[model samples]
Target: MNKIRNGSTVVLLVAVSTIMAIFIACGGETIREVEVVKIVEKEVPVEVIKEVPVDKVVKEVVTEYITETVTETVIEIEEVEVIKEVPKPVQVEIEKLVIVTPTPGPKVEETWVPTGTFVGVSNETYTMSGYAPDCVYCATMVHLGVQESLFGTKRGDAGELVLDPWAVSSWETASDFSYTDFKARENVPFHRGFGDMDANDIVWYFNSINPLTNPDSRNDTGGQMGGTLLETSVVDDSTARFHWDAFAGHTLFKTFTDLEEGMGIFSKKAYDERGEDWIKDNMIGTGPFQLVEWIEAERVEMDAVTNHWRKTPYVNRVEILFVPENATRRAMLETTQAYAGNLPIKDWQSMFDMGFGLAPESIYTVTQIAMSGNYWEYSHIKTGDTLERVRDISKPHVGDPYEGGGTTFDGNTPSMQQSLKVRQALSRTIDRETINDVILGGLGEEHHLGYVWNNDPIWQENADAWSLPYDPDGGKALLTEAGYPDGFDIEWYVGTGDYETQQAVAADWLSKLDVNVTFDRQDYSSWRPTIVARTNSDIFGGCCWGPLLWPFEWTSNTSSFPGGYGIGMELPQSKASFNIKNGSQDQAELKAAAVDMLQYLNDWALFPGVVQQPNAAMYNPDMISWQEMRPYLWMRLGGMRSFEYIQLK
Candidate 1:
């Protein structure tokens, strides 16, 4: 082996000279490499399509149709070289054997060709025939492409887009046409634009985006409702797809998006001209049902999307009529009056056993507390001379493991979180294992600070210091040192109907420390104004995480937030959170550091972590299959056995 003797050799030679002169030496790590899988990027479905039947070609179960686009942030990794040399190739003699296997050919069935018919407003412009309230969230499911502008509607309602409204407005005016002009055009003929379809064929919307185009104004960037609510569609014929709006998540989706977009967007959503509660109460959505009635926190009725492309859906439509009594919704599903939906966890099993379908979808959200200084950089703050340290005091050496589940947060504020002593004390006081096993009945999963599963590569490479260890003694010492010798009451914030196991365990453990919390919120909207909007306190508590992008979300407590030295780190920080939209990775280091710190806190219980809650749904074998799916507002129900796809059979 030969060593390079140039720029790379300076430190080595200096080290040798120093060692010889004073008998001084140090240790170093041998760089180990990781093996990688070759990803053969092969281009890798649901719903009923009007196709030739397997036997005859005529069973056209055309329910009518629709429309579709995407922005995927590219994740490219730079490979690192290891010091160890790779083994040279080894060769061996080959042996030949006679083949006993036969080439099997085919069991063939009659073919059925599927097709889609386009519906809703076609043409390049915003096409609307009759007047109907539009639900942005539900509108995203279409296979067609559409463009709406910022000037037409405001954020006070969930009608605007994700991009800048002013930017959108400027472009629209430049086009010499407003959304109204585009809306005036004649609707175009439907065509299965998305390409290749079937019943039970799963079609997806671009997370609040639709494919309906306004070619006349396609170049106009002034503005359009680029996201949130979406339009839905289905395969109509070999050449057509039907469309409508799937109305479920728009209300909440817009609320969260506004929060994520920062104060400006939040302000638009709340106090803006249209106003926040307007969207909340008006409850506009484009689904099989329309909000025909609302009684203020009471009930809602819906009518089917008219001329919804083809034969209408089954069930004669739906109604989430006010049933304040939790028991009412449960009874409705159990008795088959409401059809199907998710019920509270308490009623989950009973409904399942009784044969009602469980909404097998991603539902449970988590909240966890964690530290920032697990790494040398952030740890220095916690180990500093000043009373405030970055690392939690209880178990300074606790290893933070990554690749798992759950998120880490410092309540919702930093000043309250800006102290390591308090965070560390809280971390040590609770027992994660007990909570995981007993409280959660192991129903949920534990993750590294960023809520990444232990299987994730990031957790493997970086967060070795965040895995939690149960140690009340370690926690007590931290609390006592933090001036909470007798323990103090800290309010815990969470969503309603979150994991009960976590709350119970937290109460049990903190109670032992003479520390207690009253309760937490079940929904972000209820808790957001005070915790985030008001942004006044440091002692905020709650959890939120999802996808590979939790670090991308600002509210997450992980130091991974690129904006500021995360509150948990106890570093000098800004009083407010930073906005990092446009999917920017500019602050990646800060994000990585944030993740490191968050996980580090987890290892020592810096934040109380609950279990990972997968969006779950239960369905009767006789009715539907509750298969698992990606975390989002998506579910499949279009096969022949599907309710919408139902037949006399």
Candidate 2:
């Protein structure tokens, strides 16, 4: 039966090449038989028989297979267009103005010799009058290499602050931190024939400088160390024991080793023989440099000590010229008359464009507004003397424990609560971002939470809660709520450092709240005595002095010293500071206490931070190739240290 439709066709094709070859081998003349079938349009089939050659059949079969394969593989693809929306282009303008004309620096010599006089122009004067070890400006003498402490600060392998032994060789503290025995290095000679340094000299040095032991002593650091430093005794010629009521070894380390506030060890022989008045004008220390003369408001000349015990100065002589004018200092550097000068931040790029050398990086220093006169302590910690608290309850930013004759740091007190609000208002009124960008030239970052760094663990956790926003309206509301609807007058003290411009900006912001701010601009040396005495109740525009009560990773209280340069800040967290100074060995406990104190500071806004800026160095490339030596914690703006290792190019 045949089942083939009219439209549908079924075709069968077979290839029998092997059978054809067999038949051909049998007889080349033999004829091959073939069959053919035909079907009509209807369901009718017809059959026909035909004969074909084997070659013809094979050719026909191959042709049909190729045609069938080609018919099955025909496919057509359609093309479509895709439309996408394009965003509008934004136009940006770029200005490429030259700051200064490029100039070649001084030519370098083929043979280098580190034996020239280095003249450095500084914006600040050396001191107001005296060279006393306890003076705030005494650190300048130590930084200039004319004096050294028993211990000094240096950069560790990780660029961390480490203690560098100078006069002292080794130390051992009691288990309870009651006392520390320091072994002094022998044969350390003093300048101008003062004789060798000994344990007796160390004992005399600490006792005489401390106001607690010597009532006539005028050292400001007496307030910081006097409470804990009970006595100093000589064990032998090279050993001295410092007895403490309570001591934190780290706090002692920070206070004793600091370059800014540390007591510069002077010769006891000179002090005894020459008297206090002679010692005040003269400097005698076991340092690499010996002071030749200091002309007031002019220059301080020093000659390098040959074969110094600690370090031999590369330069033969050093001259520190007091150049208050920024332009004059820059001019001196450009003319090659000054090896180094403290220039302004705005001029740094221009100076570099003119072939000047800068430091590898800048040292960071925090600037804060110390809301001074927060007298919360009822009595003195050591002497049990009746301490006077803030009497003026009307002062906007002053906290008084004696408010309404109150006897405690009661937060519920009217004056205390009002002062807190005023502080918060002042902090919020500040435009730190704008000030950092404009005044600091982007070299500073917004700083808050007192002395804590931006990325510190405590700051990271509490940043959201602790950070005060820039809200002028909010500040006004706070001031109004604090009973200052018409605002108030504040006497803001500005000392040395890069603070004037920033303070001016802050004052402008403050004016919006009807706050009349009066700035008292004076030399820091003159202001030092008042600040140390805690006599002024006015606010200061600077970092807090003394070791920070907070346990920072760097362990540098001076880095962000609380209490506003040792102002009389008696608060509820005052005992925390006492413990830190007393020498608590427990790190975790200390950190907790520090964090608690920071919280208190933040909530009350007593000591609010503005921004942290860089203290950079700029020098002539030809005069110096390398200027770094030991670590310098806090120096003035554009100030350079470690003069002994300055390499001449």
Candidate 3:
């Protein structure tokens, strides 16, 4: 400490007070440091001093203020950043492991191998050889694809009927319906190394089958085409023209295009060189198959022609086995000896339950009773000449106009009225519904008239009038009114096929009316000739017909003409209706005529239909697959119609 003087300067020291600066930052945030620098001056209190200078004491007192030096303190603030730390993830590698299993091989015994041979079992093939056109069983050759026809019928995709040119390329009909010219397809090779077919071959075929050219010809085609076909002339190498007296509507399709009626075209050179005897057992035609061997009733073997122009058979060879017994046929199918077989209607369900496929509904034929010896036509229609007609009035169902001198309903003879009542009684006694269920296994429809299917518009419209009710009492009363109070004896000509069973069913039903029925069993080969010649005196109990591409009225309805199974007899009203169907071009007029014809046929009750039978068969689905097969719908009486469409798995 220094003493204070009046004229001296004073130096002072001071204690400093410091102020601290604080910084705040949120979590995970960066902080900025703030540096504080300050310089401050502070005032200090000083004591009063009296000063006495040298050599003199001053009487006067004086007060003076003194200035002081003070030291300053500096506070500096530095900015520092604070950052939150984050941890990094770590990755580790590990070894991989795998597991394996073994597989077993298949055994050879479990595999199936194709034998390359397909067998089809049928009830019968009467003539293994298609020797002549007149042969009733010869038409099957054309259906089997061993021969070819000039024209053929098929069902279109929409199930409508379609007539196609088979061997011929194209055809042109005369505007007056008098002639038709056809151009044969080129490069059509005949089977068995025979020369190719041409216009000359076609001319020769027609001439050979016609009675006018060959007087010895006994073919039924002579009666169908004798009066209509005048001649066939060759125009060029592949063109031929047919001259006709009058080519009516559907005449070509119904006669020439029909599988049953159409004659399979043959090679002229083969006939000229091989002779009749040699050609009888051999077939020379343009088809997709070639005949290998025929063992009569045993079997018919044929080999497929590879890469055929039309269609090639899927199997290398086909064997059609004739198994007469239905049980044997079924057994053959079950044992896999036969891939397909014709089975009875009753066995169809059991076979189907065993995974067998049934025949498609489209391929079916109608079975009925066609009364023979009912010839009522007094004159020939084609010649318009008085004819010597046979009227066997001894049969109760037969009518004789010669006795009463009239032939129409307005002036019907007594015999005609009596025959009508008797036939009606026979028809009424049949329980068609029961027969359809029991005999046909409910797979058939109960039909009332021939050539009139249940689906036909005419049949649908006239179902009530056309249908004959099943009334045993009414039948008895009708028989009593017809002067047959005691039932008479009648013979039913039976044949091999489903018709045999159908006739049996009908005869059993007829027995309820006190009618004594007798059976005249015969093979179709012997029975067909008499019917074709219109000489059969007994009623054929089983008559089968099919759906034609067009309405056919000339076959059974024609007067003194060879036609279908029912052609054994002819009627006057039916003959008149035949003319209408042949002459009229309008569909409406033809349908009207058909309705009238069917009505007359129904009222006469001569040809009473029993059931619309399906040409059904059984097949093993696992062994054979017809998945994409479109069968030929016009196969009448059913054989292997579309056998070419079969495929083996």
Candidate 4:
């Protein structure tokens, strides 16, 4: 019984010990798998190996050893450390900055050589290359601004400015005559009565008046005077006109007088009026000097009218002699024939050798082809012929010249300008760029067919699409479709006065296409007739005109292009209204196409542009104070001769 009991206790002890060992092993492995862990082995409790203390004896021993046992029960412990590798973070940086703005650039600069002190007319505005351009043009510069000097502080103050006005028969008949509305009148000639309103005596130059009484009634002799006085009358017998000197093709002279003496001159009316006389012997304008003498093409002598006006014009006596040629002027300058005069372009180079004051301004003009009601119509040649056929047709239609009347068109005629496809074909066939480079010295730009300039907002902004590239292939296709697959003959008419280079350009352009073009240069009279006949039918080739801003001013069959295009038919087509309304070129879907075929060219083409011609004034060094000023923009009151600033060496 004792052995069995002993065996049972042993079994129980072994079982308990095995269970504790398993628990310890499981806990340690779990920690190691998930973390950096450490395992330590120490002794198990001593009581497990020893027998239990007796109740009475244990109590007595506990009391005796309690103090000592309690003191030694505490154990010492040390900490374990673990380390693992992980990723680090990153860093960054930055940069510097700056800013800028925009502004206008400077104008072009030029250098010139002069033979003498620059002594040319100072005028700037006459329809040419300046800030402010004009509608009219003249041979010589209109004013003295070309010399780059100010006659006074005021602009357009032509206070006896030296001008080269042509010897004209009458202002009313000739466009060459320069006249302003002095008589405060509408469509009336300027009046310069022989009277003094201001301090000085008013001696005015007058343009002829409109026909009120018969020209024969312009008799100053009145009742008596006959014989020598009647015989010397300007027109037949006598004259009541005030501008006798200018009218007589000579200088005029007069003094102020309240009462009428022989035949007193009349005053002129203001602008926009029926015609009122407003002339005074002496007048005050914004000028430093006043006209002391009224010399026609002779010398415009001015006296010191004001403080500043009298300061310069430094030379004591100023005289202007009319000699148009450059060689003559240069020769005079070289030999020092005159104190001041215009010099040749070559002689300008020699002036640098002597060291004299000089200044030069570009005095070029804008070439405008002014188109009027006179032109050919659709009734002329139909759109299906060769160049020869048209030339032959153009033969008999030439009109008379401008000197008189001889070339009036017959009531029955047709127009050749009616076909847009033909014109487009012509445009494509010609290489305008090549012409400009070769003939115009690369100074001109290639142009399209239009009314306004592409750069001008007035024409361009208002225009529709049309200014596309010259598509020769497209033109050819169009020509073929228009029943001219074989092309037709055209007599490209040339005028007598035309520049030779332009003729070459036209020939070259025609050569590119399938046509036989011929040239026939005629005199002014014959040319005039040809123009009228051509407008009436296919008598002459195309006419190239001067620079004009609006395309319509130069291109239309009647005059000027209206920005868009339309098909012109002898009879109206059913599609006319629909195409015009529904085919809004500005619409989104067709905007690009319209822009190319219509608007662009109508405002930027050859018919209207190249407004300013390339012209420059040759000058020497001493004339230092010259700031290129725009004549149109600057000249508000008068013509181009007015100037505000100038410096002389």
Choose 2 or 4, whichever is better by lDDT.
Answer: 2
- How well does candidate 4 match the true structure in TM-score terms? 0.35
In candidate 2, list every pair of residues with a backbone clash. 246-582, 247-582, 247-583, 248-582, 248-583, 544-565, 545-565, 548-557
Superior candidate under lDDT, 1 versus 4: 1
Candidate 3, poorest ten consecutive residues by summed lDDT: 43-52
RMSD of each: 22.2, 36.2, 49.4, 46.3
* TM-scores for every predicted model: 0.45, 0.76, 0.76, 0.35
Tens digit per residue, CA lDDT, model 2, 576-599: 455463454344455566577778
Instruction: Write the residue-wise lDDT of candidate 1 on 1-649 in tens digits.
Output: 1011111000000000000101011112222232221111100000000100011111111111111111212212111111111221111121221212222233343232222211110001111111012221222212111111111211212211212221011111111111110011112111112221121111121111222332121111101222212322333321112121211111112222211111110111112344433533443222222334422223223333333322233333333332324465556545545444444334543454566553322333344543333321222211233231223223322222211211232332322332455565565555555454443334445543534433334455554565555567777776667566776654443333223444554565465566665444333223333321122132323333222222222323322222121323222221012122212222343244445544544543444544443323333444433332211212111111112222111
Q: What is the C-alpha lDDT of each candidate?
A: 0.28, 0.57, 0.58, 0.25
lDDT of 4 by residue, 203-306 (tens): 12111211111222212111111100111113211111222111111011001110001122222222212222211212222222333432222323333222
Q: Could you arrange the candidates by lDDT from highest to lowest?
A: 3, 2, 1, 4
Question: Which scores higher on lDDT, 3 or 4?
Answer: 3
TM-score of decoy 3: 0.76
